[model samples]
Target: MKNKSGSFIEWLIPFCFILCAGWLIWHLPAFTLDWVPPDQSQADNLRGLHHRNDVTPGMSGPFGGEADWVDYLALLGLPIFLYIGIRTVRRAPMEFESWRPADRVSVFIGRVTMMMIILLTSVMLYEVLLRYVFEAPTLWANELSLWLAGFVFLCAGLYAMQQRSHIRIFLLYDICPRWMQRLFDTISTVLIVLFAFFLVYGGYGEALDKLWRWETFGTAFDPPIPATLKPTVLIIVSLVAIQAVVNLISDWNAEPVIHTAADDIDQDELEKIRAAVGAEGVGDLDVTRGSIQGNQTERN
Candidate 1:
């Protein structure tokens, strides 16, 4: 068991990442809202809730908060993510093998999203406890969960690219010649980049404007969710764009992973089924294999 111990080097790099993220969040004026008196800040708009002051003309979205809950939750959550990232790297180096610098960023953000999921669950539990057990409810819980969930959805796209887990029509793709395969990859990546470019280009100014003006959500618990979330749209798509480009470059020279009729079959899986039913070995599956071949012949 002593051999299982990890050295400081295993965690050092991830620790530095978490530390830098924490320091930056701590220094941001928006997150510093905790230090200021609640009454003085937009957070103080609670208690009465429905006044025209809280729900102004058009600052916030449907939820109505002044700032994102992530500003507060990130400090606590990012370290957990960093720790997970370090462990993942140590345990599954192949997952990140051949990763470029930008790929690492997407992986980091993806890991953070996992941690955020846990925190989001906790927030829901806390809200339930407060509302039922304590007979008190928070104005922020509903809005905060939505805000966190939105980011999780947005960031997962980048993560899927990093993992190469997105859906694809491998039936046609695998049958294509090597040159055609590269052409397909190139075309897919170009389309993704163009889509990302248009999204960022169309939304960048408004999103930045909302964040810069410190826009409010016009709710009693008023958080800056609109300002933060809008900008995140541009940011997340940009990361996805970068990850797409990285994938194209990194996979350009990858050996073709051709799929065959036999490759589509699962011999090991059939063996597992056979064993589960008390078969002695794959030799007991003679009929099964024959039946499969017969079916394929009929299909052809």
Candidate 2:
């Protein structure tokens, strides 16, 4: 086993990230950007929802409290996402031979560009038709579009990590031998955990302060600003923190071994990593060989 430095400090990073994220969520107010529909006809309709202290006495959206409930559930996705991200990053590096130079960039761009284009087109189409043709607009469509945008932004970060396409300097790592490279990887991971933990613990108070205010969209659109998204942000941050921990575990003991079972297995990739990193007798499978077999099968 490669000896990891600063054992206590290594564990501390993830803890800190969790604590800081909690503080941020609990103390911070929901983020709200100004939103005004282009058309004026239906814009007035939303005014009451925007900042109406004149809320009809005992009135709420359809399925009373249903919207809020949905918001709460949506918030849960953040943590779940972060958890997935950390797991993906910490998972064993692909066997070098298994990787293509374009793979990382391709995945990153494909997800972002496709989603952005589709959303932009849809939003523009809605606006043009609603304003010029129908002369009417709906609140649900606008809000739903914004929500989709938010989700797309969230997934982008996680996907970037997965591709290992994030910026890094190779001045030292480029020339380092295998063992030395491993040492640096271990150290960097430890710092990541430590920093993440500290951020969470220190920032939790700030998040909570905002939550207590019952902040809303502050616009006619009633976006559910503070009350909705703050909680979700906290959840997302915590999940990302957990992934960091899983990453440490996966990398600290991985090896370069190959698994030859025909059946695809969920953990098969991770197992291969552990063997290779551990420098055991097994090495990475020849993906080239697999590709050849696949081609042959297609011809047959």
Q: Roughly what TM-score does model 1 have, to 2 decimal places?
A: 0.62
Model 2 Cα displacement at 98 (Å)?
Answer: 12
Backbone clash numbers for all candidates listed: 7, 55
* Residue-wise C-alpha lDDT for candidate 1, range 1-300, written one tens digit per residue: 011224454455455454545343323433323343244534433222223323232343232343234443555566665655544543233243545767667766665666677768999999999999999999989987887788789888888888786877688898889999999999999999999999988998998667554566777766567767898888888888888889889999999986566654567676677776456433544677667777999999
The residue pairs found clashing in candidate 1 are: 65-222, 65-223, 66-222, 66-223, 66-224, 67-223, 67-224
Question: Model 1 Cα displacement at 180 (Å)?
Answer: 0.5
Query: 1-300, model 2: which lDDT tens digit per residue?
Result: 122223343333333333333333332221121122323443343333333432223434333431233233335554553343232222122322112223333232233334454655687688779977998876556664664465455545544543444466766775776577678877876776676677667766665544443455555555544554555556445544544444445555556333335324546676766676455433346456567777999999
Who wins the lDDT comparison?
1
Local distance difference test, each candidate: 0.65, 0.46
Candidate 1 segments whose C-alpha is farther than 4 A from its true place:
1-97, 258-300
Point to the candidate with the largest TM-score.
Answer: 1
